[model samples]
Target: MKQVLHFINGKFLESTSGKFYDNYNPATGKVISKIALGSEEDVDKAVEAASEAMNGEWGNIKINDRIALLYALADEIDSRFDEFLEAETLDTGKPYTIARHIDIPRGAANFKVFADTMKSVADEAYQMDTPDGGIAMNYSRRYPKGVITVITPWNLPFLLMTWKVGPALACGNTVVVKAAESTPTTTALLGEVMNKVGIPKGVFNVVHGFGKDIGDRLTSHPKVDAVTFTGSTPTGKRIMQSSALDLKHLSLELGGKNPAIIFADCDMKKAINETVRSVFANSGQVCLGTERVYVERPIFDKFVNKLKKAGENIKLGIQHDESSDMGPLISKDHQEKVLSYYKLAKDLGANVVLGGGSPKMENGLENGYWIDPTIWTGLSEDSAIVKEEIFGPCCHIAPFDTEEEAIKLANDTEYGLAATVFSENLSKAHRVAGQIDAGIVWVNSWFLRDLRTPFGGMKKSGIGREGGHHSLEFYTELKNICIKM
Candidate 1:
């Protein structure tokens, strides 16, 4: 089994606490590795290292050199793409296909995009003529917020970490990343890539372990300048409170119960495929997955039937099984958490139109934390199953009589992370999308993302954005300079 250690100051270090957490493979419920569980003391050491780098060569490196480092890192990731794909699948229990096609490639893309963006970063300036015929000038310069704490979630572990790290490093800020305890292998691999690319020591660090053990200390440390986290809403709240103690800059991408609204005038076949892809692609573990699907009453019955068929066809297999469409949840505990929602839906009289239980597999795979893709109907908008984030391969379907009702249903949940509107009518699609409260809205499609666009959530889903210019802004602090001539 692999033994994972903390990555501090460009070296793998043993935990000072001499404590470790067993990392499991959700596919087989087997212990694959033991990750070093860090403590407050470890966090202090990391912060101290990062502080030194921030005040030294890394903080004062030429912008061209920083951009070149980012480019080199991206190239390294691309060259080792297959290795990353395998490790990501092993660590997260996602299908090998997804890791290859989506996660790993996007992670590399993040670095490339940010590196290119750095060359175009320019300061803003304004000049005014004074009454004495002299020129007065005001200019704004962006500087890195040193020593940022990047805490990423288990789902899309490497991809999400790169989403923050790419921008943070490009902006010249040093980072101490806390990879999720459930999946740390890919992140450990990233540490290796960082070293290979010759990123300065302490400029990038990775600490493995649970959030409770070290997350609080990382966010609350006096020297930490900012915290960028992607995880549960409850944890986001905690980070918010703790970071507020020192008034640290915070960028959080939290939980969501996203909705998919299917209009009757839509292309039925595409809608069915995209809707299923939305919820079952990552076994519905995505924060932007459409957990609550609202269909126009005219086509509701047909849509639900199609969704049920798609769910039934989803193949649940082990991570390396290329034939599989989906894989297990991250852990047995998460599997149970998702299963409880099925019971709740049943108790609320929601019709289990499709799968509502775990699947029994052959070839020694029965012990995995696997759940069959499930579909439900006959549930009210306010039902617990509809309003809450199941974060599994399950979805609740309901019919809406009018456009206004569809809009209302889409915006009903506390989360406003992402929503999808599928309709053949362009006017209606635009109309409904505009009215939706989500930060990202898809029209006639799902998961079509542009790296240059702003990505974030609204309401309780999250605070701040993390993509393109928004990311650059979040990782930096602005200083204004004024001169009279």
Candidate 2:
């Protein structure tokens, strides 16, 4: 098996603790690699390297130089696109088509867009006239926060890491990234690209391990100036509490139990297709997956039937197979968790309109963690299945008679990450979108993202916005300077 080690100071190093953990291929249910289980000592070394790079050569490099480096990294990533596609598929159990079409391309786009966008950032200035005839001027300058800890989850490991890392590095911050142990392959490959592109030593570091072992140390370390994490709400809360000791800056993009409201006047075919995509894409492991769907009463039955047909047609096979529409969940534990929800929903009297159990597979995939796409109806609004984030290929749908009730049902959950409204009535689309309490709302589309837009959640979904200027701002601090003349 291949051994994956930490990347510190532009070099790969084994953990000081001399311990390792297994990394499994989700599709085959077999260990493919061994990753170093980093300890607090490993985190300290990475942080120290990051701090030195931030204060030394990297800090002194011109903005144009930084932009050049970013473009070079992007080019390197594009050159190795096929390798990244395979690594992401093997690690995350996503279909090869999805990885090739979405994940890898988007990772490269993040770097390219952020490199171009950072060129447009300008400081603010103001002129004030003094009462005593003296002129005064105030101006703001943005500066890096020095040594940030970027912790990314497994589902979209490379994509989310670049989403945070691109802006942070573009803004001149050094980063110590802790990739989730389950999906560290592509991220390790990223370290190689960074080194080959000649990004200054210690400017980027990757440490792989379980969260409890090294994550707590990295987040709470004194040398680390800030943290950007994408994970579960519970984990985000713990990181928030731990980082509060030093009052380190934090940007968290956490969990969601999102909703999709389908109106009677919608394009039924479009609504059904997008709704199915929202729920079953990436096996419904997305944080923005629309777990609770509310359909307008007049078309509710028809919509359910269409959605059931769509779910039944989704092809589940090995990740590398070109014929597969969707692949397995990340691991056996996660598959069991998702399957438990299906049982609970059935026991609570929710009608399983489509799949409600795992499907058996032949060949070597018999032991793989696979769950059939499932759709449930006849469930109450407040049921556990409706209210919780299943994070799987399952959704519970119900009917609403009025636009007001649709909005009510959509915003009923504590999560406010993302929501969608399908309506041909432009007025209703805007009006309902305004009423929903989600950070991101799609009037007639799903997952259509622009890199320049503000992205994050409200309520328990997240703590701060990311992408575009928001991300740049998060990685830097503003200082106001005043002069008298």
Candidate 3:
């Protein structure tokens, strides 16, 4: 049987239970492989293995050596780019452009950055001579969380995993990565690369199982010193509650219902282009993807028409085709859920401007799940379609006459993850951007991220943050040493 198995103890091993589930290719609706289904028992074994690896091999390693291992893993991944992309395409249903260019390349680069960063970490001197008083000295250093439980989501599995795994390993911590059931292939593939790069056995581990079955065990595992997760809000709540038993440290990158505003003084053409890219890119499955768009009354009609036309032009098909712009949703179940949201929009009296239905499977995707890029107009901030994180190619547009109204609508949602503002008036842009309650704001750009950039949400979106300046801090603990004389 074609199989996708777990990676444990630096080796790809068959399931302990010997049970496997169909791993389907969303674009073709075919079972590409049989992924081993892991249970709570499997999680326990994996955690125990990771714990041993941490205390034995990783715990004994020098800081510099750990950094070198991270750098080596990055180099190994860089060398096998194609192999990673092929497996990613099969597992995640993302297009070639995304798998080959975006996720894989960036993931490899992230490890390299972590490696370099780790090498430079040193205790900060906190001692100074006093003219006529006794000397006082202080310094700060880093401590690794012994073991981390990484619970990642389906979208951008490899890339998101790196944002967590990179820092965890760099800090001399052992890891147990639980990938989304639909997209565990690339992460599993990384295990081979990790071993080839010389990361010791038990230092790194990957488990394949549904979140419902194996999740609680990992989050509450007494041995787990920290938990880093990327998923839905409800799920994050559960993970946090479980970890509360031990009050384990958490790094959560959860859901978002982000917004983009177009001021009356904005350049309409530029706004339209960015609006399409912001909402429809990656089939709008991004956590930071724009779900609602607010426009000024003067240009609202023109912007909506242009955005509607642009949405209709998006191409959805197979993952391998270089010309194909969009691939299937991560799975059939997700595809159906996306369609249901669109259906609910109609029920709530939201107007579908263009391409509001599922993408036809006739276009080479005889079986995979695909949806046409869609747009909704005349939606209010209170509309269910506008407030929720659809996590699909769905964008709702609302018009505002005054600047204050636009700001109100932008910050109306419970989520405060990301937002965009477009305007010829720099002052106006800055003013509106400030009033918007997002963690990150774009003056003219959207969904732009640097490996080192701090990324996360506020309010119900999530707690804590990820990326740059703060990311490495999440995987470590700060201890201060002081002496007085």
Candidate 4:
């Protein structure tokens, strides 16, 4: 079995605690690797290294030099594209095609996009009259926020990790990354690329462990200046409390119980196709993935039937299988959690329109952590299945008679991460999308992202935006200086 260790100060080191956690492949229900479980001591070492690098060589490097290193890092990651693809697939059990086209490519693209954004970003300058009858000029200067502790989730581990790491590095802030325990392989592999690209030692570090063990230590560390986390709302709350002690700069992208509202005037085929992808893409592990769908009453029945057919067609297979459309959940524990929700939906009098149980597997995949892509209806709006973030390949669809009801149903939850409106009526699309409480609202499409746009949630979904200049704002501190002529 492979043993994955921590990458600290440009070297791979074993945990001082001598404890290890089994890294399982969801497709086979087998242990693929043993990851070192880090302790507070490990976090301290990584933080110390990051602080040293931030105040030393990395801090002194010019913006142009930093941009050059970022580009080189992006190129190196692109060069090893296949390696990253395989690692991401093996770690997450997502389809090879999905990992190849979306995860790996976007992960590398984040670096170049942030590098260019850093190059083009400008600060403010103001000219004012001085009280001494002389002219005064005020200009803004941005500096790195010091050691950034990044906590990433397991679903889109590579892409999301780089989303924060790219900007943190481009803005000249050193980072200590705590990748999710279940998907640490690709994150560990990136250490090799960091070294190969000649990024200075201690500028980037990775520590492996559960959130409770060392996560609290890293977030609460005195030397750590900021924390950017993408995970569950509960975890985000805990980190927020930890950050309150030092008032560290914190950016959290939390959970979402997103909705997709399908209007009667929508392009039927397009609405059905894109909504299906939105609900089950990456087995519905995406933070922006839609779970609660509200269809206009005239087309509700037809929409449910078409969505059911699409859910039935989803293929469940292991990594390297080109024929698979989707794969298993992240782990057995997650499979159990999702399955419990299915049972709850049934118990809550849900009308199961499609799969409600696990699918049969063969060729040594019988023990895999698999669940059929599920669809449900007839559940109340306030039901647990409809209100909570299950993060599974499932959705509970309901019908609404009016545009006002559609908006009400969509925004009825505490989470305001993302939503989709399918309407051919441009007026309704604009009007309904404007009323939805999500930070990012999509019309007639799902999961189409432009890196330059501001991205975050409106409510419990997240705090603070990232992407383009928004990310630069989070990673750096802007200061205004006034000088008299």
Candidate 5:
């Protein structure tokens, strides 16, 4: 098995205690890599390095220099695109198609966008009129949070980590990133790229280990400035508690059981296709992934049939295969967790229309971490499947009669990260899209986002946003300046 090391203090190092954990490839269920597990002492040393970098080498650099460095990193990432793709695919068990076409490309795009946006915020001008005799100059000066701790998740590991790390670096903060144990290879590799691209030492660091040990040490450390996390809501809640102890500014982009409503006037076939694709994309392990579907009763029967037909066409294979439509959920343990939700939904009177059982491994995929893409219809609005966040490839559908009823059912869940509204009528789509209490709403479209748009969740789903110019606000602090001229 291959072994990966943590990037600490601009060097690759083993654990201080010489302990390691197995990192598996979900597709083959094989131990692909062994990662060094850090202790609190490692966290302390990394934080110390980050603090010095923030105030020493990184602090002395010009703002424009920082922005230019970001552009260079983006170029470097673009140049090494295949390396990231392979590392992400092997580490996270995501399809190489998505890792190459979606995640890596988007990560580069985020840095490129921030390269331009960062310069826009650096020394932006503001003026205030004086009541007395002289004209007054007033503006806000923004700077880094200093030694920010980014605690990331297993699913979509590279993409989400960039969402935090990109803007944090561009906004002038030095970062200590903690990639999930399930997928540490890509992060360690990304750290190598950051160091190679002439970025100052300690600008970016990566540590790998479990949350209960290393993650706890990082978040609870006094030197770490802020904790930005993307993961399950329960873990996010714990991070919040630890952040409170140090009064560190926190941004927790947590879980979701987002809903989608198919209006009576909607295109039934299109809605069914997008709904299935959205929930099952990334094996339903997305924070904004659509977990609940509410279709108008007028088209319920047709929707179910279309869903089953779509299920039969799914191609499950190795992550590198071009023929595969969906890949595994992180591991066998996670697969079982998602299947347990299936049992819960079954006991709640939901009717399974398509798949409910794991498939025989496709070709040589018998040992891979794979599960059948499943869907259920005829569920009541109050069923636990409709209300809870199940981060898996399972989807729940219910029928509603009126537009009001559809809206009510879609908005009933505690999660408000994302939702979709489908309608051929443009005005009705926009109106209902506005009414849904989600952070993001797509009309006849799902998972649509621009790098310039703000992305995040509401209610129990999460706190704060991650993209756009507003995202820089999270990584920066402002000091109001007033001067008499």
Candidate 6:
């Protein structure tokens, strides 16, 4: 079996403890690899290496040289595109086409985008007259914020991991990443990319294991200067509490029970197409995926019918099959969790308009973590299915009488990560987008992202923004200098 080992100090190392976690192929329900379960000892080693690099060769590297390395790293990742695509597809069970087109390219782009962004940044400078009528010059410069601990989720593993790593490295901070337990292959593979591109030893590191085992050790470690995590809200809260002792810098992009509001005047074809993608893309594992949909009452029946038909038509086949529209959940445990919610929705009297159970698979795929794309209606706002983040290929639809009601329904949850407004009326779209309490409100589209814009959640969805210059803010510390002239 493939052994997923730690990448520390530019080398792959087994855990000090000989313990291993079985890495499964979600599509086949087979043990594909063994992941080293990192312990506190491993954490300490990674941290020490990261700290040493920050205080040694990497810290003193010139900004121009560092940016060039980042660009080169992006190039190297592109060069090894097929290798990355395979590892990501093997780990994530996402479609090969999805990984080829979206994940791998975006992963490479993260490095390039951040490198270009870091190159273009201009610091602040000011001239002031002193009380004694002398002139003073005040200027600011940014420095790396020491070592960062990056904890990534399994969904979109490669893309999200690089999303943080790109900026962290671009800002010249060393990072110790804790890859999600079920998906460690791509992370292990990244160590090769870093070394091949000539990134300094200890500048990039990866540790594999369950969050409970090594999460606190990494997050609460005295040497770690910051924690950037992408996961659920409760986990984010625990990380916040743990990091509070040191008051470490935190950038958390947590869970979302995101919503989609469809107006009667929306382009029906466009809205249905986009909403289906929003709800079922990546098996609905996207943090921004919509779990609650509100359609204007006049068109509710037609919308539900079309959506049901679309859900029915989604192809759930083997991961390698290019024709497959969807793939399995990340693991059996996650599959069970999503299944429980499906049962609860029915028990709570939800109208199950579509699938609510697993689809049958044959030819060595019988035990795979398969779940049918599901749809529901006639559930109250207080229903668990309506209130919580399922993080699966399912959504509950409801009819709204007015624009005010639609907005209210969209904002009803505690999550403020993302929401979508589908309307032909530009004025109404703008008006509703403004009132929705999400960090990102998409009007007439879904999953369209610009790397230059700020990305994070509001309220409980996330703590800080990251993207473009906002990422620079988190990855570096600013120091101001003043001189009298």
TM-scores for every predicted model? 0.98, 0.99, 0.96, 0.99, 0.97, 0.99
lDDT of 4: 0.93
lDDT accuracy of residue 68 in candidate 5: 85
Which pairs, if any, clash in model 4? none
Give the clash count for model 3: 4
lDDT of 5 by residue, 1-485 (tens): 67798887788989889999998888888888789998887788788889889888798889888888888888898999888889888877778777777889987777778767777755556676688866888778887878899988888888888888889988889888899888888788887788888888788888888888888888888889889999888998998888888899888887788888888788877887788778788877887788788878888888878877887788776778888788887988888887887888778877887677677885656777788788898777677777778788878878888888878878887778888999999998988898898989988888778877888888887888777677788888878888889
lDDT of every predicted structure (CA atoms): 0.89, 0.91, 0.84, 0.93, 0.83, 0.94
Model 6 regions lying over 4 Å from their true place: none
| Local lDDT at 23 for model 1 | 87
Q: Which run of 10 residues does model 6 get worst, by summed lDDT?
A: 89-98
> How many collisions between residues are there in candidate 5?
1
lDDT of 1 at 209: 75
The residue-by-residue lDDT of candidate 1 on 190-221, one tens digit each, is 88999898998998888887778898999999
Candidate 4, 1-485: lDDT as tens digits: 88999999999999998889999888988888999999999999999999999878888999999899889988999999999998888889999989988999999999999999999998999999988899999999999999999999999999999999999999999999999999999899999999998899999999999998998999999999999999999999999999999999989999999999999999999999999899999998999999999998888999999999988888889878999999999999999999999999888889999888889999988988899899999998888998899999999989999988889999999999999999999998999999999999999999889999999998899899999999988999999999999
Worst 10 residues of 2 by lDDT: 114-123
Residue 293 error for model 6, in Å?
0.4
Q: Per-residue CA lDDT of candidate 2, range 237-283, in tens?
A: 99998899999999999999999999999999999989989999999
List clash counts for every candidate, in order.
0, 0, 4, 0, 1, 0
Better lDDT candidate (3, 4): 4
